[model samples]
Target chain A: DTAVSQTPKYLVTQMGNDKSIKCEQNLGHDTMYWYKQDSKKFLKIMFSYNNKELIINETVPNRFSPKSPDKAHLNLHINSLELGDSAVYFCASSQWGGGAGMETQYFGPGTRLLVL
Target chain B: EDQVTQSPEALRLQEGESSSLNCSYTVSGLRGLFWYRQDPGKGPEFLFTLYSAGEEKEKERLKATLTKKESFLHITAPKPEDSATYLCAVCGTSGSRLTFGEGTQLTVNP
Candidate 1:
């Protein structure tokens, strides 16, 4: 079974439309994250949630929102999509470790979004 | 701000040829370092984790080594299927989030 999985591996929509990407992890991790890999192959963290609590929100546009229903699921919703939003979105999860603890992220096969 | 830089944005090596990719980071308190491989149109696959300096780990033809300020991913006698992007990430103990570098694109031609 896939440790982490995302739905709609490919999403194509017109500009100004809205979309949501769902992510789930079977690893029973307490932390989940959404990362964006742009056309340039630059991967950056968009948001992070720990035990369904918002923990890290990067300098992303307000149009991007993340909702974590539980420790094993985190979803990313986008509003008023733009052409620049065309990129690969990845979902990742890791077991929580305190100070001096080890953390390894397991990523899902990304969702490719294309805004026309 | 935590910063990570990867060198030689791209590398092309023939089958059986070996090379190393570099990942340098400047974080306040480095908790751990990670290496990942990403095939096109797919997500990143975790490869190795380096916790501190002088640490080394290997998997098949790949070896990961950590230093005080940077990490290295060395591929030995790579094959064509080894072509993919290698990513490096660093997490700071002082902070809970992970900061990632752009990634190094490697192409192993058969």
Candidate 2:
């Protein structure tokens, strides 16, 4: 079974168009995250949700919003996307706790987004 | 601010050749260090996590070790299938987010 999955493996839209990417994890993890990987292959965390609670919000612009309906699903919605929004968006999940090896994250295949 | 820097942006090795990748980091309070392998057109796959200095973990032909300021991933007798971009990340005590390094791309030829 696919532990973590994402929808719309590829997305190409206009400069002003809005788009959303869906992510789901069946690992029964308590924390889910959204990450952006730029063309340089630098991965950065954008947002994180633990049990449906917003926990981590990076320096990302307000155009990017992450919503977690439950523990298993986290979705990202971008409003009025621009050319700079082109990158690979990845969704990850992990069971967070105060112990060793508890925070290991598993990532989904990723959504390749390109804004013209 | 927490940061991670990986060395040798890219490496090419013949099959059965051994080498190591480096990940240097600076964080407020270290929580854990992670190693992952990413193949072309795919997300990163988790490999190992090192919680503290002097810690070591191994699997198959890969072994990871951590120290006070950096970590190393050693590959022994690597096969062509072991070729991928290796990523290093660190999670500090200040937040639940992970700071990742620009990965080191490894190319192993048969």
Candidate 3:
């Protein structure tokens, strides 16, 4: 079974369109995160939710929003997506309360988003 | 600013060749250093975690060693299948957020 999974592995839409990507984790982890990998393969953090509580929010654009319904799911919604928004999105989960050594983050397969 | 730098953006080697990738970091109060292997079109897969300086971890033909300033991932007698992008990330003591490097792309030819 996959520990972390994301819906709609590939998304292709026109510019100015709105879209959402869903992520779910079955590892019973307390923390979930969203990352965006740009064309240069630079992975950067966008948001993080711990036990349904917002913990870390990077300097992402206000157009991007992340919502966590519970500890097991985190969804990202983008408003008026732009051409520059094209990138691969990744979902990851980890046991926050566990010690640093024991709480290695596990990542999902990633969702490729293309805004033309 | 906290950052992680990886050397040799890309490397090509013959099968059975040995090499090492470097990851240097500048973070406050290091919690753990992580090594991950990623194939194209896939998320990174965790390989090892180094909690402190002088820590080492090994699996198969890969071995990871950590120092106060940097970390090294050594590949011994690598095969074609061992080729992939190796990423290094640092989990800070605060917030447990990971800062990732640009990653080193490795290719092994049979």
Runs with alpha carbons beyond 4 Å of true place in candidate 3: A98-102
Model 2, native contacts kept: 0.62
lDDT of 3 by residue, B1-110 (tens): 56899998999999999999999999888888999999998999999999999999999999999999999999999999998999999987664578899999999999
What DockQ score does model 2 reach against the true complex?
Answer: 0.59
A1-116 per-residue lDDT for model 1 (tens digits): 99999998999999999999999999989988899999888888888888999888888999999999889999999999999999999999998775233578899999999999
Best-matching candidate per lDDT: 2
Best by DockQ: 1
Interface RMSD of the predictions, in order shown? Answer: 2.3, 2.8, 2.5
Fnat of candidate 3 is 0.60
Q: Report the poorest 10 consecutive residues by lDDT, candidate 3 chain A.
A: A96-105
The collision pairs in model 3 are none
Candidate models: Cα lDDT each: 0.90, 0.93, 0.92
The recovered share of true contacts, given per candidate in order, is 0.64, 0.62, 0.60
Candidate 1 DockQ, CA atoms:
0.62
C-alpha lDDT (0 to 100) for residue B21 of candidate 3: 98
lDDT of 2 by residue, B1-110 (tens): 88999999999999999999999999989989999999999999999989999999999999999999999999999999999999999988776678899999999999
Residue A94 in model 1: shift from native, Å?
1.2
- Clashing residue pairs for model 2: none
TM-score of each: 0.94, 0.96, 0.95
Task: Note the DockQ of each predicted structure.
Answer: 0.62, 0.59, 0.60
Across B14-35, the per-residue lDDT of candidate 1 in tens digits comes to 9999999999999888888989
